[model samples]
Target: MPFLTAAVVLVGALGLVNLLLTLGLTRRMRQYGHLLDGLEPAERGASTRPVGSDVSPFTATAVDGTVVGLDWFREPTLVGFFSPGCSACKDVLPGFVAAAATKRALAVVEKGPEPADEYVEPLAKVATVLVDDQAHEAITAFAVRAFPAVCAVDSQGVITETGVQVARPSAAVPA
Candidate 1:
């Protein structure tokens, strides 16, 4: 009878330990969730370069044969990185075009298995377009880590804002 009582006590002690461990684990997970909630998209691993960084020097040939480099951004410019087969890139293309309509913009398209004509045709209307194959000079220069990354850069080549969509210029009110 004593042995049976000890066995029961041992099982109860193990159950208590398990409950305490589970409660600790749950509390830790909640703390981690709160920490993640405090982070911004950029801090959470979005692929675009962070704001306040300078655009690295790079020279790439646009479709029109223009040699584009830091000098090209003599005015505020919107730059977008894209890939041919990325659905997200396609979804954001129109928004990028609209945002680039009245601003200096550059579109860098990474070559994929499919043709880039789908992306090139419309983007060319609003921005200088570059189709990059092996030489990803422009892509590397922008520190682009994912497709469809966009950034608004100042004339001095410092990135002012960056995200999955171009930052539209605020409308000015006439005095």
Candidate 2:
């Protein structure tokens, strides 16, 4: 009888521990995710040779074998990241598309190796979808945590603005 009681207590303890771990991990994720929203630049790179500026090297290709350089944007560039299957992505599509209509360069960064073209069609009206096959290197480097987020950069390859969701449907609208 004592052995059975001990076993029940052990099981309960293990359950509690598991629950606590899950909660802690969830909290950490949420905290980190918040960083994805409106991440302001701490410092600027050298003005002449900027790497992650308004026109940085976002390694994604175009349909006609033309490689796109994110850093090549001399105008304001807006970058959005989303999953193809995310419902929230669909919800915000119209707004983003409408906004992209005005921006000179608006690119959508994808998470998978599925090639950017697959997702571009859906977002074509408002964005130039690009692939972040590994996701972490490009998207995470931007510190984005949410499903649908936007970033804007200026001519010098400097990040000027970032938005969480549903701001205003105007690319003419600043980040």
Candidate 3:
């Protein structure tokens, strides 16, 4: 029947249109992905001080009342910037604490509305903990642009490694 033929043609035409539309959307997604890949870290607002950069001069008191500054890095040290307001910071805390336990580490926590006890307690066990308020000095000194920023600084006060996650130092092999 002609009606059946017409219906078949209509269905085939709709299928062809759907295929074309899907292809167009996929092509657009690829184009967007390429565009995103071309963006810089600074452009994306995730840039942090690069490795080999010197830490800016700063002094602050840790929760234990010890004065901390660049001079405090007399040995290779792991430094982490965290915030109570950031969920990512919470996720990173456990690992940071574990890693800090084995190395000389400093943990800077940005003050939030709630008490800092949640962050300070565990961090203090493994690191010299500093709880900083607005425009946190330690955060500025390290030029961190994102929460949970971490770095390894050498004795000379130059950052040697910087990232969201740094490789944990391996334990020394006993002779």
Candidate 4:
């Protein structure tokens, strides 16, 4: 009877230790999750470019190595920042292509020197495609912290709308 009671106590103590260890591990995991959340701009709630900011001064190099400047934003334009390496960028590309038919569109492909052969022709069919080496100039100017971002620029070269998703503005029908 004495030996059985000792064994029971031992098992109970082991169980308690496991419970405490699990609790500690769970707390540490939550802390790690919060730290990871801060790593992403969207998860950290960071502000991208504010609406009404002008993007006219920004420039990106076109596929043909021609300099595309602010004049491209003279009309209501949709500017998309994308990367061949980003899965999210590839996912939204079809929508970006669809939006191009309704508006003037430009796709700024991030991370130059990487072969984006597969994405080039499709994006070029709908928009002026530009390759941004290091994405320093255009990304910094537009305050784009994330790939697959889309912004609507008004005729005055001011950003009227912005989002991670590419969507076309609603058009008014003739009465």
Candidate number with greatest lDDT: 1
- The 0-to-1 C-alpha lDDT of every candidate, in the order given, reads 0.80, 0.60, 0.79, 0.72
What would the TM-scores of all predictions be?
0.71, 0.55, 0.69, 0.65
**Model 4 C-alpha lDDT per residue in residues 1-175, reported as the tens digit of each score:** 9999999999999999999999999999988886676563543312248677877376667776667677766678787787777888878888877887566877777764456765677878877787646245677778887777887777777777788776443331001
As for lDDT, the candidate ahead, 1 or 4, is 1
Worst 10 residues of 1 by lDDT: 166-175
Candidate 3 C-alpha error for residue 152, in Å: 0.6
Ten-residue stretch with the least lDDT total in model 3:
166-175
lDDT for model 3 comes to: 0.79
For each predicted model, how many residue pairs clash, with residues at least 3 apart or on different chains? 0, 6, 0, 0
Better of 1 and 3 by lDDT: 1
lDDT of 1 by residue, 1-175 (tens): 9999999999999999999999999999988896687665546335767888988999988998888898988888888888988998988888888876767788899987779999889989988999965228888888889888888788898887777765443321001
**What shift in Å separates residue 33 of candidate 4 from its native position after superposition?**
19
Q: Which ranges in model 3 have alpha carbons more than 4 Å from their true place?
A: 1-47, 166-175
42-130 in candidate 3: lDDT tens per residue? 42323357878998988988888888888998888888888777787788788888888888888888877666788889999989988
> How many residue pairs of model 4 clash at the backbone?
0
Model 1: colliding residue pairs: none
TM-score leader: 1
Q: Model 1: how far is 15 from its true place, Å? A: 17
